[model samples]
Target: MNILFVLLPLGLVLLAIAVIAFFWAVGNGQYDDLDSPAWRILLDDESKPPKDPKDSP
Candidate 1:
């Protein structure tokens, strides 16, 4: 029974911290782009090959 007093407040404090962190993340645009990153990973880069040094004038 004595442990309840400690555990209850501890649980509430942890819940409050989690709520604050979630709000902070939303305010900072953390979840603004939902789909672009996934699609970007599927896209390929337009890469160019390096030329040999002997080809230079």
Candidate 2:
């Protein structure tokens, strides 16, 4: 039908766009360091309690 002509080209364009995006992401180092973040989050940042005004007596 007439809709096939339009839908087929539209789908092809979308697929081409997705392929370009995937390649671009791979080339830009976006997928790098996937594991480093998990290890970095295990760090501890404990804060000391505030000194009370009466503790200095």
TM-score, structure 1 vs. true: 0.84
Poorly placed runs, candidate 1 (over 4 Å): 53-57
Per-residue lDDT over 1-57 for candidate 1, one digit per residue giving the tens place of the 0 to 100 score: 999999999999999999999999999999999999999999999966659877665
lDDT of each: 0.95, 0.90
Could you tell me the lDDT of residue 42 within candidate 1? Answer: 100
Which residue pairs overlap in candidate 2's backbone?
none
Residue 33's lDDT within candidate 2 is 73
lDDT of 2 by residue, 1-57 (tens): 999999999999999999999999999998987998888789877966659966654
TM-score of candidate 2 relative to the true fold: 0.65
Candidate 1 backbone collisions, by pair: none
Error of 2 at 39 (Å): 4.1
Q: Compute the lDDT for candidate 2.
A: 0.90
